[model samples]
Target: MAIEGPFWRAIAVFRVASLVYATVLMAQYRGYEQPMLGWLVIGVMALWTAGATFAYSVRALRRWPLPAIDLLTALACLLASPYVQGAGQGAAGTLPVPATWVAAPVLAWAVYGGRRAGTAAGIVVAAGDLWLRIREPDVPIMINGAVLLVMAGVVVGHVARLAKQAEARMQRAFEMEAAQRERERLARDIHDGVLQVLALVQRRGRRLGGEAAELGRLAGEQEAALRELVSGTAPQPEGATDLRTLLTRHGSPDVTISTPATPLVLPTETARSLAAAVGAALDNVRAHCGPGARAWVLAESGDGTVTVSVRDDGPGIPDGRLEEAAGDGRMGVARSIRGRVAELGGEVSIVSVHGQGTEIEITLPA
Candidate 1:
């Protein structure tokens, strides 16, 4: 759309130049038998050129009527060529009334209606010019002029169309980026306040027992569901988000997270999901290994892949414990940790010893 400004300005400049060229040609030829008529037509062309230049500068005025009037006026000038120059003057090398000034209308049509309108305007103006010069010996020159007019129209129209399409795509991308930012902001707000409160209620209710415990369990379930919703793995917008920036938020005194000083960039959704999976692993440590248990999260990148390890210095899982939990319909590790990583074309491996500790490693293509 910004290109329209420069295009119209160029059209204005072209009109002024063509007007001067037509004036010089007419003065040199001195072929007008009707002097007053010749001067009157020139006056009309000059006034119209000024008016069109001003009208096109204002976007609202650049519509059908302006270009239509412009084409008709140019055609009228071409038709009046013989009368103004006298019967045999056109054959004696007299110029058409508007001369090169006719290109103004052709360009206007091209800008407004693209290739089709441009070609149509060119054909109509060229037809009128040729009709007036039908008996001239230099008929080939008129034919060549017509061809040039058509080509100019097509080229200008094509450029205008491409500019419009590019502008549209830019607008859509801007809007989508704005929406993505808003979604992330809302997700952050929910994660910071609502999810934390729900998780606390669930944990406390189980300790209190009775109906309070039941309420806490319900809240905990809702919290897990909400966390999933907030950290949804929807396809990201083009480009990468810094994974280190996202994971840094999880650092605490009891749980230490170590990452490379350099930025770790991945698709926006992938980074969010990976961070959520890490959070889920930390949640498991706090729930099963006591809140005071120490945990370390380490991130490493190499060989076109990234690996994150979450290890806890707490009693390790007993053999078949995970299977027993799954049989009882508890899917904390199954869905929250492994499921999230697997969706990103990654693999999750669990290593645990009866007394020493437990470690979970997630490896994904970079």
Candidate 2:
């Protein structure tokens, strides 16, 4: 939790107020049996208050020991009330030695440890005050003070916890905003510099022919990959896309794609993710199976769900092949296909039979 500076300043102010109140009560009553002892205790409290204010003001010193010591000191004063004011003196309406000074430790606990600690501190102080007034008859004042102390502890602790949470959320929002801005700037730089050069190289190399044409094809593939990368990183507008349209674009002479003629609209992000997963499956088919291998993509939408299956009529994956690939840290199936679908609240399944074919199916909620 981020402790604010103003909270410590408020604590310092409370300590000073408590000290002033204690001093005034001691002077007003003048009921201590040992006047010298009472004065000595007042002087000690004054000095301690000043030292505590300085210690808490320094951020590094504001930790467990400080608050523990503060609580102990306040409790000690409360316990010593009988000695300072004399037995039966409080019964005659005389104030305890620390009086309002007890609030300092209660507030410190609330700021440091929130509601639970605050309540504990309040109970401890109230118990000590009650012990001092145990012999006094008609001690309603002390009981009322105890109630108020507990209430203050609870309220202050709750507020402090809320403030800390609010600060954390604000910090996270600022960090995310900065990261988005940086991603946009990098996307612009790639589009203007690397992407343009790659496109020009591909165009010029294709016109040159022969080995140059093959290089041009590779360059064209790289340019397409770069475009996809930039598009994925760039911020997207809120909208929906027709899933059929997106999938239909992936069909080629070597690959067959089938989808409903009617539009299947989905959130832009969900459609993009599903399309990317299907693309990964197709890429696997092209890389592992021959480029000439025929593949079919089938899409179905019904009952608030959409299913897309990519099947290829090529030599199927041998048993344990995927596990062996995974052991070698090849995560194409794990990350590219399964990871994408899982993130979109979807699932991916693969079925393969040796010498028959392989099929990858993805199911997603609409």
| Every model's TM-score | 0.56, 0.67
Residue-level error in angstroms, candidate 2, position 182 = 2.5
Stretches of model 1 off by over 4 angstroms after superposition = 135-141, 198-366
Worst 10 residues of 1 by lDDT: 228-237
Q: Find the candidate with the highest TM-score and give its number.
A: 2
Instruction: Name model 2 segments beyond 4 Å from true.
Output: 1-3, 137-142, 198-283, 292-348, 351-358, 362-366
lDDT of 2 by residue, 1-366 (tens): 445678878988988888898888888876578767777788878887998899888879989999999999888877777777675466555778888898888988998889889989999988888777776665644588888889888988898999999998788779768876766777898988888887887787768966775576567666666665455432233498777766765665456788886677889989999999988998898788874577899999999999999999889999999889999999999899999999999988899988888999999998
lDDT of 1 by residue, 340-362 (tens): 99999999999999887799999
lDDT of 2 at 352: 96
The TM-score that candidate 1 achieves is: 0.56
Cα lDDT, model 1, residue 170: 88
